[model samples]
Target: MRIDARRRAGLRAGGVAAAAVLALTLAAPATAGDATDHGRGGQDRTYSFTVMGTSDLHGNALNWDYFKDAEYDDSAHNDVGLAKISTLVDQVRADRGARNTLLVDAGDTIQGTSLAYYYAKVAPITEGGEHPMAAAMNAIGYDAAALGNHEFNYGIPLLRTFEKQLDFPLLGANATSVRTGRPAFAPYVIETLHPRGGKPVRVGILGLTNPGVAIWDKANVEGQMQFGGLVETAKRYVPEMRRKGADVVIVSAHSGADTSSSYGDTLPFPENAATLVAEQVPGIDAILVGHAHQEIAERVVTNTATGRPVVLSEPLRWGMRLSVFDVDLSFHRGRWSVEGVDAQVLNANTVPEDPQIVELLADEQATVVDYVNSVIGTSTEAMSAATARYEDTAALDFINHVQAQAVQAELTGADAALPVLSIAAPFNREAAIPAGEVSVRDVAGLYIYDNTLLGIKLTGAQVKAYLEKSAEYFKPVTAAGTYPASALTNAPTATAPNGTPDYNYDVMRGLDAPLTYDVDLGQPVGSRITGLAYDGVPVGDAQEFVIAINNYRQSGGGNFPGVTTAPVLVNRQVEIRQLLIDWVTAQQVIDPATFTATNPDWRLTWMGEPLTVTP
Candidate 1:
């Protein structure tokens, strides 16, 4: 999972060379246009075209059920559904005829919500079964789409069957067959569009999944295939596209752009790929990106050598926004060059829903509604799952306490009195068990990823290093501060206004033993951790203690140091969700007042003053 920085540097340097060649080949002075202008230059000789893209649909075919209501409400705020997208596509096509428009998706279309879960479990797309996503995409008419990492969640055989149901081609330049050495899926697609009274223009579309797919879903994809680098694959395919009579090349990249430097074993910056592809990929005019669930429009990436503009666009997730890129291509000197380019974000809420697509999703809608609405257990008092600032939640603390106790019992024959601690991530604080009937859906909020429990032995020094690594997620208040503003800020400053900290940038669970140290936000990897101790005692570097955490952390999910090398004490067959369920069942009655931060060793302060925590 380690990203070789040298490899990234080499790729960037290669991009410069490729950009130089592309500049010489496509050197032509051309006019520009705006939202009103249809072409680049004078008269009606110019060919105008539009590319529409969608990403991270996540199987939200219906509106979001925030209240777990049986009936869906289209009028709700940000209620993004595929039906709305269908309507918007129709309207756009009607406005700018089919000949001038191309529709594309950036993947992650088959997972996330209850609808997708039910679809995969109840009536999967097999030899004789029907896939609703295929039918929906066909109804709306997609030109091509890239394969997302999540597509491999069901394995290759089922994926091939799912692909068979779609009318449009699935593109993935880097994904190749293990046995044949050729592409397992279509690498790219060339489409010929003829504008009114104008010559036909060929558009080439290439697809790429995130390169990290190998690690994310290794069990499903590793044996059958290998995913090549996005930049390298695009460089290989773009020239071939042009040789095959394609006038313009566009990359439908499932990888997203990143501007942060928090690179580690798990989190990777796709900006490197984006920069390399834009500069190196010959004939590529624009890139439609996804997988980050971020909203980007009309980012002008300059080719390092050529200085030409490569436009990039990404409209948020779940059918919320449609990215529209207008490009004017003209044939001169027996070759087509991009004359003008502009992009915009089309709001899904502004358009009316299409009735036909709604009817198509009716049965699927009822199934999801019932699944989320079915009650499992009830709580006498509201058990708030919220993770307070510099503090843990009662729900998560209780869950971790159970896991820690379980680990201790398993390791020491149920009679040992070692100070056992369990680690739990705080990002799973979105669900609240209201003072009423709690369902299986409510349990999903406490433990989302279905991670398994893992017990390992770690010394106090290693535990402090792990905490320091976790603290790296936040920005320090000073040159030597432990807390991030998102974790400890009390009110609006010149910086953050909302006063509410980001939940993801909190202290690491466990490590309740106290210690004092200076934290450097900009410290180099492996050096950020120092002044390590546990329980007012300078812990011996060789001293080992049993630590409890989920299987993800055990397998290096969050990039915690020394975790992968730790000795395994117990591999609990039960999932984290099952553990939470069992614990809740054992407790029966829930109370929010009992919820308190168990780990007192973790603390955050701003400018040497301790920040207040609000429940």
Candidate 2:
């Protein structure tokens, strides 16, 4: 069996290939006696292989919730994490026989939750350190993996370090180097499957990622790496893989299968184009998708060229689900041809937690719990972000307050005199700060992303235009019929998957006229934000000012206009969460009365009519 990998480019069967295949002998991950012994006839006998995948595992290593600091179990009796799924993985591998099973992940593995943050931010991985997330997967023995957008969140060095620590190849066909225009990582990988007694078959697994990474991780990936459209890249690579003699091809797309182009035909390339890959790229047998966090159990798109059906599956985020693909092959005309292909998703809630995985990361888990438990500051009032989605909540206010204040502290002399504004979004609706001791966890929850503060200079008209683009988050209320406030916010549809995530919508805090959302929803978009002003004075197109934004938004993550059209003042490579932690640690008290003194600068009301604040 040949294991094709990296720039070495050819599968000459590495030195350890013979011994490696021995470990996957029939039933090794699971007991040998329990496996489903498949196959019945002779001569023209049929062989089968199973491909299991997980995606968007945002660092949920154990069935443990860092928020609750306890074992996680939802009302549906479902628990999450690769730990629980390990048991299911073992069972599936055993049932199908290890040699015939290939385990892979669709990406977004290293950065999420307090535990993951603790590793990436708190305790840096040294030369021989035990990275808990990588350790967990190494124990599970993944065959090949893909790189998700979040992988670049910790910067290039850390991502590359994590890559070196991995036992498998991190594939990303679209992640190209800016300088050379070549694959920065292994574009695709080949996992050779040795059937029960027949010859070995090569499975070509191609990895594609969302092009939005160029905007989302602009700070880390700007000059270093570039991402191309998924469809075009696949169109370029799939045919090449076929020429290299792959029996079956599987795509591990870190992009959603949805064909939505959120930039509205404006940004020429498609970001979430896994469906386009299946439809446009030929010779692919199956696709495993992620990044949208939707559950795609099984979907078959007819190939535009071959007319053959390509099966696609997406396991939801946070290790809550797993996608399994089974392919039956038969030797005919002296070649192994894919006879049938089936795919389905399995929930992690259905199985018990793998005690072995729990044990493997127990020490690291305990350390993270202790780190989050350590007090950072105190609050005089409980600030809840839950209502921030609908109303002005202190939780969201605290972040805006932090950003405006942080930027203010850094500015000096005449440049600082320019009217300063801040743009913030409510990341976690459930994030709160208790009116007592605040821990590292509380601050982390308040600012969920690792985005840094960026100062952009824009005129009043440009800012208004930016807000107008953001106002598009609301579905236009034609002939208004008592539209609920919740309906006034983002409701992601197929056409606009990148629509306003609660955290992506920009809320300005410097415009003086309380930029009310007296939205003319009955009218078209770009006419929502009104009553704009600065320092109680009417503001118009000529007014110029500086505004603080995160790197994500500054780089146009939500397709918001401004960064590309506005002037960039500075990008202080400081993580906002750390600044929040520092601010709280220095202040020692988060008094709502002190921080929540400013009146809301924005509100949602109907144009030429009044909209009630229900609460």
Candidate 3:
């Protein structure tokens, strides 16, 4: 990650000019909604246009669930993928007419499942090869798209391959080349809409991505690409879009709407800043947000500078929902003026999968199915990840075990001496390893995300701080209420505040210690974790330890304190899934007794005033 010192110096040399250019370009503009003012008698022509946006598709092109190893169907009651989204796209385009509709995605299309992994890691995008994702999006006729942080997961070379294959431009205004101080991709795209009996409507789309990519993809982008803050990038580009004669400006932000800095405010970049960009930047007409999988039908935020409304929408992940923005434009005095704006969601499940998309990607889908279903190992009994949130179940421990063993093997004598703990979260509640033979699909289901493992050095106090933050996943319990009943109230998974996803709630394994903690309803969040011990010994500040964690946490993805800058003891440079497959093949039989030899490694309990664990 260390850039060449000379290159670093060179960047610093032009830093002042870059800053000046940014300042000079971001001059405020007039309010967007005030383009036409007063007099109903003088009113001019009006026309309707529709904008459709999708985000976090994550390579789900077929109506097939990789985990189930079957074609996704309504009987199974799952949302499925892009093939289904095409159905909704057809409906919207038909209703609005093909020329009046603009379809765009907010990134995260290439790194979620075995489908994407196969293209990037297995078969690979060769000179003549066609990536299923690019083929599907091209078939769906996307106008433009934003780059999600995951776009960098397979490194720049693969991303470039996918980008070139796309018929539409990939917009990443903030993802700039450190060497050039310019955008790595197109900053924004302007699509002029042709409305009947009115001036052509110039629609501008500016894409912003999560700043967390600088950390999450540090291995791939550290010295290559530098990411600027979303607000800063938006400020620099929104004005340019307006000056380019854009009647409507839509921001396709691959970040979340949450404005608070997840990794503290010290750094210039904030991980999720769509809300900040919309509020601060004046000319935004609508915003499509992603990288946070939560769904929003539509929300309008008033621009802080102009007091004009900025409509926002987030389609749920895996192409289950499409965010639709139907805009009414009043064409007056030879220009298009904003009149009314609205946003809504169209369910992909409402219709059947598009046969054309399914037929196009059928081969790649079958290849991935064969790839993920290959047998790896055997299990004594059926294991389910469903209850890992509540109990320190074997399903989660199995992953921790594999990760810990892999980390242990990678370390030498001295590095191994420090008690190692591997922290992991149960990402899939429905994932299971059925009894008997275990295939790659079974293991993939157990660990759903595409995160690589990193073993880092941590002091006992840092470990405590880390777990305390994770403890925020639980709601506090009052002593007066019935004990366990009130305790597990918010214990249901995915109850994190500020729209934080629950999969980030991590638990650790190693040292044969249970993560026992009590939350006092009255106490502050940072103090929630107590009774923290490693092998019956209080894990104090002085004790040193080696901890294995996913690259996401190590990248400060969850805003976990002290993690982003933590010293890396080892980088396996291997995907945890392959590591697990290797571990499973070596072990042959995965018996529950092996992992359950020790007591539960973590517990999120409830307490009241004076916070004490009940007997």
Which candidate should be chosen as best, given lDDT against the real structure?
3
| Candidate 3 Cα errors over 4 Å, as ranges | 1-43, 71-78, 376-397, 404-419, 424-437, 448-507, 511-538, 541-615
Candidate 2 C-alpha lDDT tens digits along 159-190: 87787766677788888889988788877776
For model 1, what is the error of residue 499's alpha carbon versus the real structure, in angstroms, after optimal superposition? 3.2
lDDT of 1 by residue, 1-615 (tens): 112224323433444211211211111121222123234553335566788999888776655552345333444456576788888887766666655678899887876666665566546766466566766776777777888877876677777777766656777777886777677777887776655444567788888876656655566776688777787787788888888877888889887765321123333334226656787665678888787777887787876656778898888888888899988876554455688778887878777677887788777677666866666567766655565334545665556666776677666553244456667666544667778777656866766564657677788778777766665554444443344434433333334354323432324333344344433334543454444555656667666667777766776665678888776666533456656655565676555444443344444444444444444
lDDT score for candidate 3 against the true structure: 0.75
Task: State how far residue 73 of model 1 sits from its true place (Å).
Answer: 10
| Model 2, runs deviating above 4 Å | 1-43, 73-77, 261-268, 378-394, 403-436, 444-508, 511-532, 539-615
Please state the error at residue 135 of candidate 3 in Å: 0.6
Clashing pairs in 2: 517-603
Please give, for residues 1-615, the per-residue lDDT of candidate 3 as tens digits.
Answer: 111233323433444212212111111121122223333654477777788999999888987767677766454365768888888988877676666777889989997777887788777895459889988887887777899988888889999878777666788888888898888887887776655434567888888888877765677898889898888999989899889888889999998877654345435777677788889988889999998776888988899889999998999888989999989887666677787789999888788999998898988877888878888789999999877765667988888888887777667768878787888886877889889999987877887665778788888899888887776665655443444423543344344445434576788777344444444444456797767777777778878888888877887777787787777666634567766765777888989888764555555444533322331
Q: What value does the lDDT take at residue 430 in candidate 2? A: 72
TM-score of 3: 0.73
